[model samples]
Target: MALAIAVGLLLASGTAAADRVPLPALVKAHRGEACVEPLPVIRRDHMKFLMHQRDDTVHEGIRGARHSLVGCIDCHAAKDDAGRWVRIDAPGQFCASCHEYVSVTIDCFGCHAALPTVAFRKTAE
Candidate 1:
């Protein structure tokens, strides 16, 4: 009871910024600053772009690089300690970390490969 009161007093005094929860750590994209859209725009509209791209690919039979899931996996997939590529939707991985934090259901990997089929090495600088 005493500990709880102390915590409450600290919070009520504005000493605790209640909204300052740590966000999930995101992996850097392989291409760094070469995303199709700017960071803010992409963070806000990535779902919309993915859905639109899905519609076009499935119904219209059109596939392009601009918003392709393949492109995303290729660019965002990280490596394991053994040098194998990790699935994008796995826990702590690119997709799962954020989606879990935001309470969003991730259904994309249900019918799609979460890791690229081909290997992609970072280019030498």
Candidate 2:
């Protein structure tokens, strides 16, 4: 009876550990210029920045600000091994990986194009 209880406890602990969320696979950003804000600031308040940028663009007739969504797509979008452009919000890609990690369902790509108009050549490693 003691052996059975020990085995049950061990199994329960293992199951609990396995239920923890694993670290997300973040995409490596490839950008020509530095980001609009520091990494820590951007990580904490990016949604607020994006919302403000959208308001300026739609209501104030402003466009192409540093915080614009198009700027983000241009910097974060990547290419596959085949050299074809990959969507920023694709699985394991830039936007999707982080949003999915936090259990957030985003509709940013529903209206916006995921690919950047400017084509970037992968730098030679």
Candidate 3:
């Protein structure tokens, strides 16, 4: 009976890992610089898998957070220092720049938004 239970648990665990979309390697590839490609669109089912991995309840609010409506480049792409949108290097500025135009206060930066190099120094840490 114990052997059967262990087998069941192992199968369940394997099924869970198979559901999530692997995060793009590009996001972390450039030394934690912003991703060059659009962030992969993780589906709702995959998000549910992630919440389950965290042992959290699958609430509607949590699911909403999981749905990917846009890719990172949709928000981050901008004119570069070389006068081209494709070459923009500063990524945090990508989000911040738009928020300013929209007249919205960006609180995410208050805790989370430092260039990757300064992320370790964040007070939230």
Candidate 4:
């Protein structure tokens, strides 16, 4: 009877651990290519990289070829059912998905456009 209780408790704990919300599925880039960095690297250090990129652009006027938030928006922006581009904060959108899953507040849209630029939209068209 004690062994049965121990097994039941172990199974319950395992189920609880498995109940964690999984990471959201990221939309493919407009060009259907891989990201600038690997998934694990971006997952761990993307905020650090974005901050550095922001500083360089703001202070030094040197926007690197990659790692800019604008670049990410250009690539990851999604379209609505009506074929109109949607903002990053929209539900199921690229940025919102992961941010919502992790319960993190995103402040980028407060200062920057949440959707891709007109030029980017034209290029995709």
Ranking by TM-score: 4, 1, 2, 3
Over the stretch 1-125, how does candidate 3's per-residue lDDT look in tens digits? 99999999999999998896343222222233444333443322433444453343234334222222222333334443564334213433554443444454634334432333223344522
The sequence of per-residue lDDT tens digits that candidate 4 reaches over residues 1-125 is: 99999999999999988897567787666754788889889878999889889888999998745788988888888777888888878888888888888888878899988887754554657
Q: Give lDDT for model 4.
A: 0.82
Which runs of model 2 end up more than 4 angstroms from their true locations? 1-23, 119-125
lDDT of each: 0.82, 0.85, 0.40, 0.82
Q: Pick the candidate with the highest TM-score.
A: 4
Better of 2 and 3 by lDDT: 2
Ranking by lDDT: 2, 1, 4, 3
| lDDT, residue 64, candidate 3 | 25
lDDT of 1 at 122: 65
Candidate 3, run of 10 with poorest lDDT: 63-72
Worst 10 residues of 1 by lDDT: 116-125
- After superposition, candidate 1 runs with Cα above 4 Å error: 1-22, 120-125
Residue 66 error for model 2, in Å?
A: 1.0
Q: Report the error of model 2 at residue 55, Å.
A: 0.4
Instruction: TM-score for candidate 4, please give it.
Output: 0.77
Using TM-score as the measure, name the better of candidate 2 and candidate 3.
Answer: 2
